[model samples]
Target: TATGKGFTPAFVQASRGWTAGQWAEARDRLRARGLLDADGELTEDGVRLRRDVEEATDRLDHAPYEHLGQAGVERLTELAGAFTATALGNGAFPVEHFGKG
Candidate 1:
């Protein structure tokens, strides 16, 4: 996930696998589909839709293993922080965004 107020489409596109042109094209398609705003930010409805999709994905990712409880949640949170550090090259936890505190 992105940190802080975040950056422009250039930054986001660079982070993903798509080239700038491909990113632009895909972004246009998404905007046309009402998934993004004219400026490329997510619209209010898009925000809720994305949140629901993310929740569903999270549930699916956690559903396969049984017997996971509070302890498992804590462990997964820690592991997620570690994963963000290793994968993103940033060691700090974006607690302000994730509401961990």
Candidate 2:
């Protein structure tokens, strides 16, 4: 899905700590399922699947944030923002691959 979203395989593998063989197998499976192309680009089905998965994840993850309440959530976000920026500046993750969300 990261590849589908324009992230390079090397970046994904490095960031996720996936062995080359493991990444290859996953890529092959996605391609066989018609979710990815031979070049690793995502098909429309892949895009939809990624979106659904992300939505489901967000829904499940929201409970803790809800428990924190709006102000708490805002404060958490503010606190994290600086750390995130520092990580970005330090090349903890590729800035180009990081989305605003």
Predicted model with the maximum lDDT: 2
- The worst-scoring run of ten residues by lDDT in candidate 2 lies at 92-101
Instruction: Give all candidates' CA lDDT scores.
Output: 0.65, 0.80
lDDT of 1 by residue, 1-101 (tens): 22114444445555566797897788788788787887777777777777898889899886644567778878878998888779657734343333322
lDDT of model 2 at residue 60? 91
Q: Candidate 1 — which pairs collide?
A: none
Model 2 vs. true fold: TM: 0.77
Model 1: how far is 10 from its true place, Å? 3.6
Which 10 consecutive positions of candidate 1 have the poorest summed lDDT? 1-10
